[model samples]
Target: MSQNGAGVDLETSLGYLLKEASSALRAAMEEVLRPLGMSVTHYSCLELLAQRPGLSNSELARGAFVTRQSMNVLLQALERDGYVTRPAKAPVGKALPTRLTPSGRRSLGAATAAVRSVEVRMLAGMTETEQAGAFRILRSMIRSLNDGDGNA
Candidate 1:
């Protein structure tokens, strides 16, 4: 409820709607990824490595929206499973740069297709113009929210 006498209306709350949409998208992605034995974060890490090889664990964690510890754990499992590889020692700094193995690339290919299908389905009803407009709107909203100072 809001501070007013009346409570906040869920039906008309854009934040609530956006969160619901995000949850639905995640569920759909998980459904498709489950058969491939990958979670959304797992797939995200692989995809990030494929696009930008040699990303550090911290970078991968930020890209995948996971914690550093969580990313380190996943990287360990991926190395064990032959999906990714990292140097025995960091070449320069404390950051162990990670990269995708051949096996990881193959796995990412399948996951990419599955994730793309989910996105296509989500945008099925929207025309190209509407899709572009929605993209711009969403980006603007994100920028607006992120522009705030930490004092808030």
Candidate 2:
């Protein structure tokens, strides 16, 4: 704690710690994905599609935490490269559902392995119980933050 108490104590702040952890994790993931010609968002999109096929662009954008316009640009490139496919016309509304091509699946397989390695490395010092506790704690933090009103 600071004597003046004028601002946050970054060393003991949970928000600062969480942001630091997130940044480290992102850097590690990027290092592993670089050789595979994939970015974090690209891998996220493919992983999401593999788990949930027929996801619309907007849905994918949300899942990947990118803007819809950025996702659309990526989708266009993926479609052009035959990594994914969307129907010529929407079966329902203007939302075009996307699916992974065989190539995309193969690519995702490698990316998944890489990501798993990073996660394993990050959790190397933790026991099963500790990991479970961490999961619960992190989920609680997320829920609490999301459930809060504007006024803290």
Candidate 3:
């Protein structure tokens, strides 16, 4: 393996591995989410809002690892679909907060079940200890790649 301009070897690059794994992960998650009438993107937004309960579009974007502009476009669609609400305008005249509607919560709850089912299948070959160790190793690798900057 040789380092190129980006300081990664094509033959043994973390980016390549991560990209492939992420694609697979999304595909599996999407398979589960689709039956619940949701895309992975929409489910992610709903899950984030469910957890934080009133995040601005920008904040939700960052938390969900998406661009602010992209998040706003999705939010608009969700709002139109009656899956989310924007409440009143923000006090700072900045980004308004978004939250899931009852329907969104119900749909996301169903999708969450499907996601867990996929996770169980993905981890079927591993023992509980091995699963934890795998999670630790991946987290360490991500931390090393991110350093202190994160994906921001």
Candidate 3 per-residue C-alpha lDDT over 1-152 given as tens digits, one digit per residue, 9 for 90 to 100: 36466756666876788798789988999987877778888888988998899899999889888899999999999999889999766857687978788988887888888888888887888998998998999999878768867455
**Relative to the true structure, how large is the alpha-carbon lDDT of every model?**
0.93, 0.95, 0.85
Question: lDDT tens string, model 1, 52-78?
Answer: 999999999999989999999999999
Model 1: CA > 4 A from native: 1-5, 149-152
Residue 55, candidate 1: alpha-carbon lDDT: 98
Q: After superposition, how far is residue 61 of candidate 3 from its true place, in Å?
A: 0.8
Candidate 3 clashing pairs, residues 3+ apart or interchain: none
lDDT of 3 at 7: 57
Alpha-carbon deviation at 141 in model 1, angstroms: 1.7
* lDDT score for candidate 2 against the true structure: 0.95
Please report the candidate that would top lDDT against the real structure. 2
* Model 2 per-residue lDDT tens digits across residues 12-123: 7899999999999999999999999999999999999999999999999999989999999999999999999999999998989899999999989999999999999999
Which candidate model has the greater lDDT, 1 or 2?
A: 2
Worst 10 residues of 1 by lDDT: 1-10
- lDDT assessment of candidate 3: 0.85
